[model samples]
Target: MARTSVRQLHVTVLVLMLGALSGCTSITKHIGASPSPSVTEQIGVDMHYHQVLDTLGPPTRISALPDGFAFEYESFRIDERQLGLSPNVKFLRWFKLAYGTARVARETYTLVFDSNGLVKAFGNAREDQDAGKGLAFQFIVTVTQVVDTRYLDEWPGQHAWGVSMLQPLPVALNREQSLDSGEHGIEQRGTPTSSGQRTLEWR
Candidate 1:
């Protein structure tokens, strides 16, 4: 119940942001501004990747590919359900919804630049990589989903939440590498999950 309500709220907020973004299309941005800016003009036609980073800083999501890499800028709201909250809220809406205590996090937006420092070729050539897939480059992280679709890259792995917060939640590899699934709460898309582990491989 709590997770449901939280998702509904997230949808509501996203709808509102979309409505606002509609008016800001082609909106150019500079550095140091709050909420950053739209990702299109930052990396589209005639635009270079370095300029995007210069104006937007590091991308929110980054992934590697066969020949080049991809840059992804994204924003998300990690819900209580994502952190293992379904058990307590299964049949108690009033207890959790009316009086639930789940922390919320926010991000403005991200900028994605391709390996050769160019814009991606997608229908929304103007829209940021966060809204598109088939990235010839690196990562893609959104409000409810994350995908790593690349070739020739040495992918990474993760532990079962690790034994300590001392270690990263989904630990990363040295400077370059790093790293998924479950019915406990998360449902794997495009692929089935094994009993209790998420396998790693190059795409």
Candidate 2:
């Protein structure tokens, strides 16, 4: 099981490497080549959509436009693995000796374009932020039980659950310069979730 997991991991990473390599080539070929659409390079609202697509690509998401237009782009990373031994085997080594391996991925992006072709904004929306007026989450989840546990006669004796979380952060690639340039006005926090949850889960 361990060997097989390692092999699978190797294959998965190989596939990702190929994908990245291919992306580099394709991305470069299109660079500096997209046509300047009518009203394409404007930085204001009400821009061109086709030029945006030529510059970026099909939006990952799109808002229903009863009156106006908006679009978003999204991407994700997926990891998977298989672990060893069976729960019913009545052997601790089953789980102790085996567990699958996978990946912790971080390649996702989102771009929201208002009706006027130019990018309204771009970000990864898989975050807890009131500021995320445009971003959206793109993630995949797979749930599975250990083989031994599934076959074991003692069912649900030791209840347990798994949890996962992610947060988005961006680092400046250019010189550090604030719009204020001279002063920093920051808001201070008083507590951590400090307020706390008002309602009980059971209630």
Candidate 3:
């Protein structure tokens, strides 16, 4: 019985060592991206819905709107690397803590379609950011901001084929645009008011 117990202990240690080795290696996870830039440029108002499906495959989410439908396609990639003491160097474990670095890249494409099955408007947004947690902060620092922009067929007070689509307040594209329009302050927090306008909040 003693010999069997010793063998089991050895097996457990070996398994743990292998796991540590694997963690030390960089790992990457990704989702779909096929048609590439061409598909992005091709998406425009009045484009056929079938063409969208053929170029980008099925959307990740779809919602039914009163006049038509909304389709959203999203793809993201995560890259991670483990640092600090690993089981391969068990002696260092007593002095060093495990930490890691990670990067996330995301892309979202949205298309709004009318009841006729033709695209009414489209938007594409992309983001890349770095993140780190735990004791790693002592050695690594990262700062990032997440921003999303949407382009619609119409702007404020604009109507499309008798349908009025609510538009968010215009966001200046550059210093020049801001100067020309003057500063338009937007509330970043608090529940939406009865006016039906939504605020932008960063996480």
Candidate 4:
């Protein structure tokens, strides 16, 4: 009986230690709503400004133009994940590893109105970035893991769970144009482009 009791105690202690050493969490934050793609379909040149507002809700910003005024809609999103390894003991806090990654996405829509309160031109732009990666020893903090830096190239493979092997393209070109202005513009780029209105997506 004594031998059986000793084994049970060892198993329980091991389980507790394992739980304390493996602590991880994920967080996602979104600010503002993505512009509706269908809104472009519903809107047209000479459309009343109030009609555009009624279809798209409210604008993020408004600017006065020499011809009239402009309405701008914007959206932003953030994705973060963290992994922590350390003993539960307070004294062992310094013996910990923190790893994490953060991603950012943004988009914008612009409408130029004539003095008659009618839509004269419209355009859209979007951007997405890996932001970066983070790694630290002996601390309770969030990590931003960016693999492009190659700083952690030599890091141990055991931490594979916290590492992202894929690297985003060095640069992407985003072009925004007014449906009527017939102008060429270049902005930042991230993922593939789709037809109609643009929206943000996480991989």
The TM-scores, one per candidate, come to 0.31, 0.30, 0.49, 0.53
Q: Highest lDDT: give the candidate number.
A: 4
lDDT of each: 0.33, 0.31, 0.51, 0.58
lDDT of 4 by residue, 1-203 (tens): 99999999999899767756664656565666756687667888899999998898777656556678887676666666667787667677545676678777777788888989999998886777675777656454443442233321233222332322232231111212211112222222232334322221112
Which regions of candidate 2 deviate over 4 angstroms?
Answer: 1-47, 65-67, 86-106, 115-117, 124-203
Rank order by TM-score, top first?
Answer: 4, 3, 1, 2
Better of 1 and 2 by TM-score: 1
Model 1: lowest-lDDT 10 consecutive positions:
132-141
**Whole-structure CA lDDT of model 1:** 0.33
Q: Per-residue lDDT for 159 in model 2? A: 25
Worst 10 residues of 3 by lDDT: 145-154
Clashes by residue pair, model 4? 132-145, 132-146, 133-144, 133-145, 133-146, 134-144, 134-145
TM-score of 4: 0.53
lDDT for position 199 in model 2:
14
Regions of model 4 farther than 4 Å from truth: 1-21, 87-90, 136-203
Error of 1 at 165 (Å): 15
- On the 0 to 100 scale, the lDDT of residue 82 in model 1 is 16
